[model samples]
Target: MIDWRQLREIITTPDNVPIIGLILAIAFYVWYGLRQARANDRLIREVEADPGRHRKTQPYEEGWEREVQVWPYLLRIEFLAALIVTLLLLVWSLCINAPLEDPANPGQTMNPAKAPWYFVGLQELLVYFDPWFAGVALPVLILIGLMLFPYLDASPLGSGYYTLRQRRVALGAFGAGFAIWIGAILVGTFIRGPGWVWFWPGQTWDHTRAVYETTRDLPDLIGLHNGVAKALAGFVAIVLFYAGAGRLIHWLVTRSETDRRIYRATSALQYYTFQFFAITILAGVPAKIALRLLLRVKYVLVTPWFNI
Candidate 1:
């Protein structure tokens, strides 16, 4: 059972109050998305019914010309929204000071010291990854993946319009990734209390509670943690995961591919290469958590410099 009083107290904290507004904003965005999706679906059905009429009215290539000018239509809307946001921020600042702590003392470490709100997700990631990977490599890889997304996704179904059915795969993947980041931020902000221990809604906030348990590496889970064999096994696990999943997804999604072997090979290579990295980034945390809970596996990949 949850303690409503405790939950309310936690949410009323300065660090957590903004999340209420964020939630409401997300709800509005979802409602808007649904309305837009229904409209796009109806338009698509109408176009499919009378292809010649729709093409003559709105050509596929010159679809950009069908849009209105941004000067007033979109720009004014955005400008007014920004002005309202700025005023809200002004009021908020005047009423409440930003959450800040006193000057750091090297001698006394702050218990459960946290990063900035945006970075709290990365701080939470430290539980599953080394700092080098969580704080540095993961963020770098995410940026690189986002930059490479255009090249990876060659589909033109949702080129100039918003349609859920046309771009479900891409949007679903993005939404899932965004949700993971947001969940991490929430956990770091409210669920994590003193000493970086996870505190549930009903739990008492015990500052003196110790949470210092030695985590075990995956190799150690199977009675092997040292030597080249361990690294080989780790690499083999990752390769098998990608190879099996990639082949399966390719078969499912590309059943209508051309019979040209060379073209198919090239396309499959490109698609699976991108999928390998993206899936790794998306599934890394959940995989670690599952392993930790089920098999007590700590690090899935261990090297001299880093363990992930």
Candidate 2:
């Protein structure tokens, strides 16, 4: 039977409220953005088919100036938007209580002690990865990978417009990462219960629940017993993954003629940099998650210095 009370408690938690809001807001924006992108793509196709006819992406009366004054036109919209947001915040503050708890006591630690919602994704990673990797290395890699995107993307299309046909690869990579990050946050907030145990939305939070599942390393699964041998096997596995994933990503990103042209234009340095980040961050996150959750594999790469 479903534990509705437990689910309600979790959903109503002050700390979780913003996450719920974020999910809703992101869903709306994604739908709206994709809808507009599709429309723009269609318009582009029509324009290309018939260049003799002049067409604007947005329909405007003839003789209307392409640009409007920023002082009243743009600032008026911005001011209204700011007022709406401010009013919403004011209402929210009055309705919902702040997520403040009693002062911390060493003797009374909260079960499933979680970070703030924003950092909860990283906290969830700790369950599947080593502390150094999940907490420090992964976060740094994500930031660097994000910063490298503009430098790596050679596409001139979709600069001033929203269109999937023009920026599929770029959008797809970003979307996948974003989806994974949001999924982690959702799981950490709602699925994790007391003692950090997995609990479905309607499942009761069993404080006394004790799970004793044994997790195995990748090398150990294939009968590699010696320390040096296990490390070698793991290193080989990581290298193979990178090699295969790079090829797969390259094929996917360079399928279209335009994409292939962009690939040809990209420098060797840029291509390699893109592959490194895409394989490690894009392909690696889901791969590790599958290994950990499905295969119960821990530490695919283990060495004296660190484990991943």
Candidate 3:
């Protein structure tokens, strides 16, 4: 059998590097693309001037509307941003020292070390919900909701325009998610460390352990089957409030107590404010359960891995 690691080392050596091949491949593609563009331009002019050569020759010269696609410009920005982020990550990985924790023993954990950064938000969520809800259902629902976003709000109002042309609903969703949710994740991951602690970290408090203990007690919630029950109740309450509030506002607007247009504008804000809580409740479920695993909560629902 081939020694794969040895083979990889040989192929990756400085003398045998693939960079030379990449340069040549790029040069060849540039020439080939220019040639194709020139040929296409030549064909278009030939077809436009004569009636016999191409199939669709017209009696009168057809007027053409100039169209410019914004995608190419947007694509360049996206590509540049990706490259910059990748380079920053590489520098960070090299400069920052992260020593692996002491050898794993089944019953012990290292004092300050924890799971990777991306998972901290989800880990933090467990403080609010059940493990099944926090770990599985909530995360999955959030992802599914994000994926269905375009389909759910398929308005063509701004298709030929930019953000300024879109409805307030899209704008409100963007601000809530980008400004609030994403900023919290960034602060949580970078600013907070050790024990799901919040607000000013120093040698003064055991925020890490504090966060952990609080999350652990989350699952033993009084008179609770699962966090799903609490979330469902919250959902029902919010729906009733939103319906009542929206109708009252609309009726007031009809009487000219408020501007009808302004009331309509707030309609998106009202709809989205409720959606914000709905998603949070759904996400909090599994997080709570995962926290409770420490207390030995016997969640009767079986895992698929167990069945297998």
lDDT of 2 by residue, 1-308 (tens): 99989989999998899998999999999999999899998988898999866656677678888888999999999999999999999999999989778898999988989999999999998988889888999999999989988998888888877899989888998998999899999999999988889998899998999788899899999999788998999999999999999999999989998789888989999999989888988899889999999999988987888888
In order, what lDDT does every prediction score?
0.72, 0.90, 0.46
Q: Can you write out model 1's per-residue Cα lDDT over 1-308, one digit (the tens) per residue? A: 67778787777767777776676887799788867776787777787898764533223564356678889899999999999999999998898677767887898888778887778889998877778888999899878877877666656567776677666556655776788888888888888888889898678778988876677777676788575767777777767766766665455444443212322444565576567655677665567667775766777777676566
Evaluated at residue 256, the lDDT of candidate 1 is 43
**How high is each candidate's TM-score?**
0.81, 0.97, 0.44
Candidate 2, residue 111: Cα displacement in angstroms equals: 0.6
> Which 10-residue window of candidate 2 scores lowest in summed lDDT?
52-61
Best by lDDT: 2
lDDT of 2: 0.90
Across residues 1-308, which tens digit of lDDT does each residue of candidate 3 receive?
44555445433434323333444665696577546545545555575598466532223344653354668977889999999989977875686444455677978755434344455556655544456665787678667666756554534543422223224445454444433344344444433545545434222334335542322122234454355664444445445655655564345334432234434444465545435533444223332334354554333222323200
- Compared to the true structure, candidate 3 yields what TM-score? 0.44
Tell how far residue 200 is off in model 1, in angstroms: 1.0
Ordered list by lDDT, greatest first: 2, 1, 3
